[model samples]
Target: MRKNFLHFLIFIFVFCFSSFSKSETCGGADGLVCCNTITSTSGSVCAIPANNKYIFTLRRFGFENSAGEVTWVGTETSFNAALSSVGASMGNFISGQSLPEGTYVAVRPEVKLEMTVNGSGVSTSDSVACTSGGDQTENLATVMNNLSDPIPNCSSSPNEDCNTGDGYMRIRDTQLGNFTVTAATARTINFEFDVGSGVLFTASGGNCAFRSMGPLDVTMSFSN
Candidate 1:
């Protein structure tokens, strides 16, 4: 009788542990989606330029709860930096902050549409190498201003599909589904930026001109 009771207690503990572990899902509409490549039409391609430097400002960062309400973690401050420089530094954005204990499903980041892209890519139109004169800030406010979606739409079927002339821009939001905040512990989010297919090149006046800021591969991770 004592052995049977011990076995029953062990079974109950295992079942409860499994149930609690399964409740925390890390991906979906409520979590992060990392894409390394852009979906493009035929004859249109994306590549990392020789010197690709993407600079933008992060305006706001926060998390969304299951109730569709957002819980902001920090003040509205301009964090201007190059895309390559935002890896481990992302943790600083939420430093010294605590979230209300709840299950969060999404990450919200308000970014300024004005960005600078400096790189050189082989033009799909004529296979010519095109490069930006320097770091020229392009205002993408017309297409991506105040856009909630972080994933950009770069599926336009054209020779310059990834170029601004064709009105192609890549933006997509990162989801963090069902992330529960317990005890308001210190948390950090890590980011990996893959610029392999981040720029599209086109021939302009016998020189390479930036057509548009192509899809940027961004992978995000969270830890306590």
Candidate 2:
């Protein structure tokens, strides 16, 4: 009887330890979605198909006002491995939300749109307003400035996405540096992001319009 009780207690300890040691896998929505900016002659893209394990949906949209384009293209790239790697390493991947630990997805989708605004939408010299997300939308310039270099109140200011100056822009997962993807599904890097903006840019000012670039619902998948 004594031996049986000791064995039972040992079993329970091992069981609990094993369960606690297991790393949570991906399955449901990780809750955080990040977006990176890329310039395109085609135009702004919103959504990309969710077929790739790591999906990086690229969109190109410039801010416009009644006067003209408030924001112009500085730079753009469709294939950025290093940036994607940083994305892959970060982000919450659980068993219920997001992809599984070793799951392999193989399709990439892309969409485009544009953001046009007015003079009132931008704020050139309002530090207090720019710092506050609530007061940043005074005009197209303010909105674009806020998007690229928002002066928000947080332990860390000026999110990583906007750290890089110039035409370069990116919005990464908020969970970055706090989350990790398992080595199994981490073999290939996949990324995805959704962004919205109402900022315009121009040397001076003119009638702003992105018109319509239609949608390029293209699907791309790779099998391992």
Candidate 3:
């Protein structure tokens, strides 16, 4: 009997130690780190605008299982997430939505491809400055589809273009990291937009006549 009791105690110690180690390695209040970074290479030079705004519509939020199936939750919502040197949040779009008790391998978010970016850029040819006027909304789907097409001039001016009145829309599926949900668990998910090097400026017709979207870094963090 004494030997059996000793073995049980050893098992408990091992279990606790394993759990603690996992928690430490994860390095968050919760045991999961669901962070993802996204980038694009559409521009020659990357920069951060003085006042950058990334606007998009959150069509749906869901979770992916190990078998690559998604279970969706939440309603459609629009978010105008302003990004800066520090980064910005899109708020809790999934609030009040409950997920079934299960382990999810990834997060799937359906968003509109239409996004608006507000920033400034300089032309490398003649050191000319360019602006999107105030904000330029473009369809990423269109841009992606027509990669070889010539970039439209922001204005008719030879030196600078500042038209900024374009809009388009499409839907896209974005998948982030993995997480698990239980009946007793309370989760907090944060969508961080890092635009440190997101704006791009290019020369057109020997002048700073075009301003286009650049690389963007997005991070999604989950905690309790």
Model 3, position 141, has a per-residue lDDT of 52
Off by over 4 Å in 1: 1-45, 50-52, 76-84, 121-128, 141-174, 184-188, 203-207, 222-224
Among the numbered candidates, top TM-score falls to: 3
TM-score against truth, every candidate? 0.55, 0.21, 0.56
Error of 3 at 65 (Å): 2.0
Root-mean-square deviation per candidate = 15.0, 21.7, 16.3
Give the Å shift of residue 195 in candidate 3: 2.8
Per-candidate Cα lDDT values, in order, are 0.41, 0.21, 0.41
Q: What global local distance difference test value does model 2 have?
A: 0.21
Question: RMSD to the native, candidate 1?
Answer: 15.0
TM-score of 3: 0.56
How are the candidates ranked when ordered by lDDT, highest leading?
1, 3, 2
Give stretches of model 3 more than 4 Å off.
Answer: 1-46, 83-89, 121-127, 148-177, 186-188, 204-206
TM-score comparison, 1 vs 2, better candidate: 1
Q: Report lDDT (Cα) of residue 161, candidate 1.
A: 14
Error of 3 at 90 (Å): 3.8
